[model samples]
Target: MVIRTKFMFRAGVTVLALSFSAPALTHPHVFAEARLDVNTDSNGNVASLHHVWRFDDLFSSTVLVEFDKNQDLALDQSELEEVGNVVHASLADFNYFQLVTHDGKDVPMQAPERLIADFVDNQLIILFESAPDSPLPLSGKVEFGVYDPTFYTAIDFVEDSYMTVNNLPAGCSSSVVRPDPDEALAQNQQSLTDAFFNDPTGNDMSKIFATRLELTCSKDS
Candidate 1:
């Protein structure tokens, strides 16, 4: 099933700068540029959809999962085997060590190279790529709810941090704050608002410094 959602916010500034002690991280910021597009059908009822997702991780996975088999059922040796009989380079036979190392899979890296997870629409999307190989920012599909962990969990085996309410700037509109600890994420959507654009220049971003951000995590991890 294809999950349809719109991730409520985006960063205006580079966030990687937040983690000073965490060396495993390099690109901590999230950037997205959506091409607002309109689709026309037989009756001329204009439908709008942004070919959205400045997902550096998602973009790269596409390159990998492109090797998938089973008619898009999943990515595995069977997919790679389609191109060859021996199937030397397949998902199952992949070297996780190499994948993690290449993708910076730790403090430096947030998500795994390959993943499949339950989205807000509660659907699983097969991630086929990693980060952007080119200089340009990466992007993909458009989402509709607010759940970094929900989206990140599939690709990221472990969640270190994300766009959280604790760090939210001013001008952000929502029921509350977002990108908080996993346990605390199960609250009202009001914690997160539909105000932030893909740009980092959110209206309420300054709140990060002013607010006490109600978060739930070990103070000293």
Candidate 2:
């Protein structure tokens, strides 16, 4: 999972247009702050948990979240619970772990084993999965809340993946592995960050808004 702490990098896939109440999407300008991503394990289990809030994209926005596991991505058949600021979303209820089948067939979804969470640039991602290569098609729903972020002070939650996750660092150089792993990982991260944050030469932004994200079958795809 990939996440953006300051702002979200997505404006097309998750939410297309913004509310007039928010009005950022009326012109569809890029919002490169405050977002998250969640994926599944190779066996379709959620392997991580990541949350980031870019203080810059605020309309008194209380929170930005994605809910409704609405799919069969090997849920644990349990409800979600939260204690104070700490929230717990059951295995199947994560953002990207939502299971999608070829013809709506039930498959193996053991439960949430692990969660991979990250916040880079203006995006955030959380992935929960057990194994790898489980033939699980990614599908799920996300929710972003904007209660009163307009006035809230900026939050400091940006850090390196290794520093934040407390892992020993896999030391992957890039998303692509041909020659250099370290350089590649760094480049991949920077490239993704740049794409999400930097607007084109002629494009500019005025405001930011939050909305729903719907990813479903293409009907004929």
Whose TM-score is greatest here?
2
lDDT of 1 at 13: 22
Q: Write the per-residue lDDT of candidate 1 for residues 37-84, one digit (tens) a residue.
A: 222223222122112222344533442343443355454554433322
Q: For residues 25-73, could you state the per-residue lDDT of candidate 2 as single tens digits?
A: 1222222233333343453333333433433333212223321134432
In model 2, which regions exceed 4 Å deviation? 1-97, 130-221
Task: Candidate 1: list runs displaced more than 4 Å.
Answer: 1-33, 41-44, 47-221
Supply the TM-score for candidate 1. 0.18
Q: Candidate 1: worst 10 consecutive residues by lDDT?
A: 14-23
